[model samples]
Target: MSVYHRPVSNIWWLKRKPYILFMIRELTSVFVAGYCIFLLVLVYKLTQGADAYGNFMVALKLPSSVALHLISLAFVLYHTITWFNLTPKILVLYRGEERIHQGLVAGTFYAVWAVISFMVVWLVLGV
Candidate 1:
């Protein structure tokens, strides 16, 4: 049989985008890890005494670091939303018909997040 194939298009990431996106998402954690390391250093500096803590704070307040933080926060927010959106798929609990229960799955995920948030605020505010 003679072959007849269409040209591949840029929009056709159906086959590649998932892997590409997964790699992008995977690498994005570098910023998250870096943030944690920075926090740990801050903690260490605080324990070392006030002067060290002040120096750490001043270093963090540098313009370049401030910009890095803003960008990392944006990346983190995007990562969190995308990650939580996929939580329902992994949690995979059902309450009704498959299509109808999808809402339940999503709702439950958000509900848990809300509860955890409440607990966090209560702890932080000493309520």
Candidate 2:
């Protein structure tokens, strides 16, 4: 009988900076998904009644909930930035015979993200 060896180590992803960042980016989705569920719960609370919604708002104001939100926010920002950085690889642009620079591609994504974010804020605030 032949013994099989495991191909991967638990710390394999931490061997390099890029690998560590990639793992973190992938992990961020969990927090993002949790936040989405949290938002859905908030909406459900709103549907229940003003009192439920008020209770949810108060719960969100608790220090533990605030810390969780702040941590989730950090993960979300890291995920967004890393995703934007990788956009150039997935989105190829050619102008005539020449391919566009990667920096330009990432810059364009960042610009579009900023514009869309501003638009969302403007609409939300009615400003």
Candidate models: Cα lDDT each = 0.78, 0.93
Q: What's the C-alpha lDDT at position 110 in model 1?
A: 74
In the range 1-127, model 1's lDDT, one tens digit per residue, is: 9999989877554478786777667667988998999889888998899998888888887999999999888777667767877776777754475544555777776788799989999997989
Best by TM-score: 2
Candidate 2 Cα misplacement greater than 4 A, ranges? 1-7
Write model 2 residue lDDT over 1-127, tens digit each, in one string. 9999978988998899989988998999999999999989988998999998998989988999999999999999998899888999989989999999988999998999999999999998989
Colliding residue pairs in candidate 1: none
User: RMSD of model 1, in Å?
Assistant: 5.0
What lDDT does candidate 2 reach at residue 56?
91
Once fitted onto the true fold, the runs of candidate 1 whose alpha carbons sit more than 4 angstroms away are: 1-17, 96-100, 107-127
* Clash pairs (backbone) in predicted model 2: none
Error of 2 at 19 (Å): 2.2
What's the CA error at residue 30 for candidate 1, in Å? 0.9
**Estimated TM-score for each candidate:** 0.66, 0.85
Distance (Å) between predicted and true CA of 15, model 2? 3.1
